[model samples]
Target: MACAGLVGCASVAVTDDAITQRTAFALGVDRKDLTISNRVDDGTTSRYQVKTRAGRQYNCFVGGSISVLGRTVSEAICTEVGRDGATRPAVAPANCNALLKSAGKC
Candidate 1:
């Protein structure tokens, strides 16, 4: 009863297209040149691993809230992955320094 009320009745689904688009835009690449290596969906949030044709890899996360009326609001974020498995805010060949600076992640 009370627990049910606390749970959301609506489910949010994150599409591959959305993730790919967001990743491509963040890396300043074309969608055709990017490949999605993995995707994980945890209810209202989704995480993806995207790789570029140039061998760059990124980790992308997109989360959103869904209203009872079925309205969804989503936000996406991406970070580059180094060879050591560390995450960074800038990607190579994409002028990401400026992007990271603007996003306050640099």
Candidate 2:
């Protein structure tokens, strides 16, 4: 798993309250109408952005991840505050620019 070392990731799970608060402070998003959760796979070097609908209480994910043996390569949880006073949790894309625009480390 030497390749695993080349790629690394992390994640965090927060309550709806904490997510809302942090998202507001960081992204300036206000409105506890959404939930976000993401996982990162280092194997294929891909990230998945799991986000819930503002009107719904289910998480819908976007993005791609590396796969091996029909399984995920790496898994991580990213916690941060985004705009609108809501916490946005998404797999940080492998792309530098994409990752930078994902969310804050809050």
Candidate 3:
């Protein structure tokens, strides 16, 4: 019994003034760079970036800490869906059905 719907994701920050936003993994990593991914100004410290193939991206965010599994795995959400259609706007990574489901953005 999986709920078919878009997983609504939000942003999380490590500090109060820190402008760290989380983009879904599906649309974030684009081998080159994340276009639609949120970023801070020049003075601000925004080094959150990941390298992955297009279409495989989904429900991932820029965490302030390093990913333990080498790949930045976003287990920060709790949900499920039947399909995946969301993207992070960066590398246009391939979408994952399971990620979209768990991320609540399908």
Candidate 4:
């Protein structure tokens, strides 16, 4: 019973549309240009692989939250994946710091 309560309190179902929109904004591309796949969910956070029409691939992390008041998406961040499998922030250097700071990652 206690575990169930905890799970309910901590879980939020992040919608595909939300993820697509967030990824598009982060990658500076149109939502229609992106294809999302390989979703892995853990608690309130979900990770997905995004492939763009231009053959670029990205890893996107989306966090969601549910409270007594309502449900909301906490954050979304996408990073480009190199051919060598390295992940780098997709945002330009000029905006990278700001983006990371806003995401509470820096």
The order by descending TM-score is 4, 1, 2, 3
lDDT (Cα, tens digit) per residue for candidate 4, span 1-106? 1224323322345778888887887788998999999988777788889999999998888887565656677556877888898766676667657657786433
TM-score of 1: 0.67
User: Candidate 3: deviation at residue 12, Å?
Assistant: 16
lDDT of each: 0.68, 0.36, 0.30, 0.74
Q: What is the lDDT of residue 82 in candidate 4?
A: 84
lDDT of 2 by residue, 1-106 (tens): 3334322321222233433444334333354544554534343333434333443222222222323433222223334446565664443344336446654421
In model 3, which runs have C-alpha deviations exceeding 4 angstroms? 1-25, 36-38, 41-60, 66-99
Q: How many residue pairs clash in each candidate?
A: 0, 23, 26, 0
Instruction: Work out the TM-score per prediction.
Output: 0.67, 0.23, 0.22, 0.75
Off by over 4 Å in 1: 1-12, 68-73, 91-104
> What lDDT score is found at residue 56 in candidate 3?
36
**Model 2: which ten-residue window has the lowest total lDDT?**
56-65
1-106 per-residue lDDT for model 1 (tens digits): 1113333321344567767776677778899999897677666677788888999888888774444555353555778888998877754445547766777666
lDDT of 1: 0.68
Candidate 3, residue 58: CA error in Å?
Answer: 11
Lowest-sum lDDT 10-residue window in model 4: 1-10
Higher-ranked by lDDT: 2 or 3: 2
